[model samples]
Target chain A: MADEAGAAKERKILVAVDESEESMYALTWCLKNVSVSSNSKDTLILLYVMPPRTVYTALDGTGYLFSSDIMATMQKYSNDVADCVIEKSKRMCREQVQDVKVETIIEHGDPRDAICQVAEKLHVDMLVMGSHGYGLIKRAFLGSVSNHCAQNVKCPVLIVKRPKASSGSS
Target chain B: MADEAGAAKERKILVAVDESEESMYALTWCLKNVSVSSNSKDTLILLYVMPPRTVYTALDGTGYLFSSDIMATMQKYSNDVADCVIEKSKRMCREQVQDVKVETIIEHGDPRDAICQVAEKLHVDMLVMGSHGYGLIKRAFLGSVSNHCAQNVKCPVLIVKRPKASSGSS
Candidate 1:
């Protein structure tokens, strides 16, 4: 019982990663800033949510159907991207902190919903993610993922914005 | 110097508190989850932004000239609320964490801009705040402070949302 109680207190921080440098910056920032506890009990979970593949039918307005070969190629590209991102994040964590435990999770769905559901199911202590910092017009069209997650997640959500001035340099 | 470098590495977490229970809940959550480092060098700053008081004059629409005494009384009321909230937050922090360094600051301005400015000025490692979780109708009327800060603040911003299911019990 005591052990369970102790285990429950261990922090599980989930960082939502994508191909963007913004998300990578957020991951690096979280490692340096939040994962440095002396006890090192905090576990960093790198989560990559693959956007659902859109299926096209003959009835669609475009009147074109994607062949299985093309679909397979697209899926392969996505898988490669996810693998590349997770590997880079893992290496960054290794370089930034010692004895910091990192776990990677790849999920498929709309990222906004998937991230929130994973955080809830895992009972993560905090969720760290990056802001796309979309302009008013862009946000109106694309909607902000970090904003959506911040509103929906059960745990606290940290949105890290890559500073405009430092964007070129980074 | 080595000391300066060590101090620079120390995390400065800024929590924006108002009279709202949501803000208090964020403070409590941050204390338990974020400020548990064994080394205890992380400094927790409790910042309270008092909304700018509107000055009334005869030229203003629907203006009834307020006497000096009335203005003084209103000022006193605002001050009292700030003091009360700060006191409660201090007590909660004391009860929750051991040897955690805390400092308090009071500023007067629009909370959205004031919080961003303060967080930038302090070079805070992260900003911890509570989301009002306003619905579309309410949010359209009153812009979200957490959302604004999350977008504008240079450092990371953690917006804690009070779960609706637990609102009544809390």
Candidate 2:
């Protein structure tokens, strides 16, 4: 088990994917870049966070009714989203990398927070992600996940840009 | 004229924009984050490369024959792209800055090389950009722009990540 962990101990790269073309570029880039040496496993962890939804539960006897089904359904949706991200990530990895272990994670909450949490938990050597465009007002008001991650995370972060038609690549 | 040049003194910022959403985010972030005092004029030089089109151009004489036109169009497009960027940047700077001028530059070359050259030519105080994700292969094979910029550029480089959603404005 120790040897397994050590052999699998490649640089932990946490890539946050939003399923955009930019995210896909990041994913593809990682598969091509990270080494799969025996001692340096270079594990790739793909993460996706679902935007949170607020549902009114109950208001005493005044005006609302609580529904367990709603919560259950939300959990199910979370799982489904995770599954989708994992499936897509795995497919991309298979095409680009061989004999490399890949892990997929899906979480429910703010994307930036979830990403930071995972990075800390996994002790990732570096974090890789695609930038999602958020304007100044929106970013100042709502905040940008990438900015937050860059500021807070202990590890170095790699943010990839989407390819342009003139960029000459798919 | 000297005063205008002095007033319009060039402040170099290594602006990296791909067709990616994150690159846009980085541009937006720079517009908001970079400070332009009354004494200093600022130039946000936008840099982009057409990737490796040499192969495709080699195959199709059409692509090669029209290379000059393509370059000219790219220059025009760069101007247009820079116009949009400066417009947005000006909007962000409206309240925060006064008497600060903006200049846009478009170059067709390797993104990293173009950035470094501009930084050197203008003797920039700092290099600011958004990160692009690169895993091992692409990083090893092509090299990451951020990493290369950090290693090659003499000035300090700032790499901004997107803000996290959960964290309130900072």
Candidate 3:
């Protein structure tokens, strides 16, 4: 066995990441505000969900109609965005909590479903996310991803909102 | 000056309160999970927002058509619900954190607007609320109160989710 006697008691926290300033602020807030005492190891799971390319994953769409070039472009675009977000989150966390162990998850499909599914599958103790995001065209001002995950996930959710007037926070 | 030199540094956290188990669990969760070290005094503000009696407040409608008795009854009902919820939250927190200070505010309006307004007016450091509440049929399982506050409020919101299988947590 490893030298760590209390590895079994580690707390797993799932943090959602995206390119939005709010999302990066949430990552920084979690590192600053969340408890990571030395007595028990806690893992911060950074998750970036990419929307599935509709031409490829849509149930009724004809995959052959669009040609492979279009599909490849969309796929590559999502991959690049995912990579960018995860790396940025890593950089942010390093500036805040250098000793904390971090893990990254990049997945495809609906952001809401993907976050909830991963949190449940991993049995995380808590889910942290930005209060609002920039996606969804005609929905409420509140971002749907944070709202849906907060409701469905069986863990406490910390929705970090960047204070409207506070530049000193982040 | 008062004997306490650091009273100005106390953090004011406002927790939205209601009769739902989710809200009560949120209050309990705040006491157990949030920082409450002896060195820093954190005050918890218990807020209960009473939905406005639409018949009395609607601008275009014949608000005057309704008898004063009808308006009074609706007002009384909201008052009763607000009172009951505030009392219940006080009782809940007493059993958890005896030293924590609790304050209750009841206002009549849309729950979404009222919660955000009070949080700003009071200048709370953090807004704690239950993730899912009993409201809105079309929203993805998350309630509108927690969702809207998380989006509009300037303070960080902690949306407590009662873990589905954890009965012993409280």
| Best prediction by lDDT | 1
- Using DockQ as the measure, name the better of candidate 1 and candidate 3: 1
Docking class of 1: acceptable
State the lDDT of candidate 1 residue by residue for A1-170, as single tens digits: 11221232678999999888778878877776667646478889999987566532232336465666766777899899999999999998887788888999999877778889999999887899989732345446658988888878877798876656655553
Give candidate 1 misplaced runs (Cα > 4 Å).
Answer: A1-8, A55-67, A133-141, B1-8, B37-39, B55-68, B133-141
Put down candidate 2 lDDT per residue, B7-46, tens digits, no spaces: 2234556666555444555555454334334334566555
The lowest-lDDT stretch of 10 consecutive residues in candidate 1 chain B is B1-10
lDDT to native, each model: 0.76, 0.58, 0.72
Q: Which ten residues in a row have the lowest lDDT in candidate 1 chain A?
A: A1-10
Q: For residues B1-170, what per-residue lDDT tens digits would candidate 1 score against the true structure?
A: 11221233578999998887778878877776667646377889999887567643332334455676776777888899889988888888887787888899998867787889989999887899989732345446659888888878877788876655655553
lDDT comparison, 1 vs 2, better candidate? 1
- Give one digit per residue, the lDDT tens place, for model 2 in A1-170: 11211222356778887645556665664454333223235677888876565422333223445456756676687678667767888887766566666788877666778889999999876677765523244346557666577667755565544434334654
Candidate 3 chain B minimal-lDDT segment of 10 residues = B1-10
Question: What TM-score does model 3 score on chain A?
Answer: 0.79
Question: What TM-score would every model get versus the actual structure?
Answer: 0.82, 0.43, 0.70
Q: Let me know the TM-score candidate 3 reaches against the reference structure.
A: 0.70
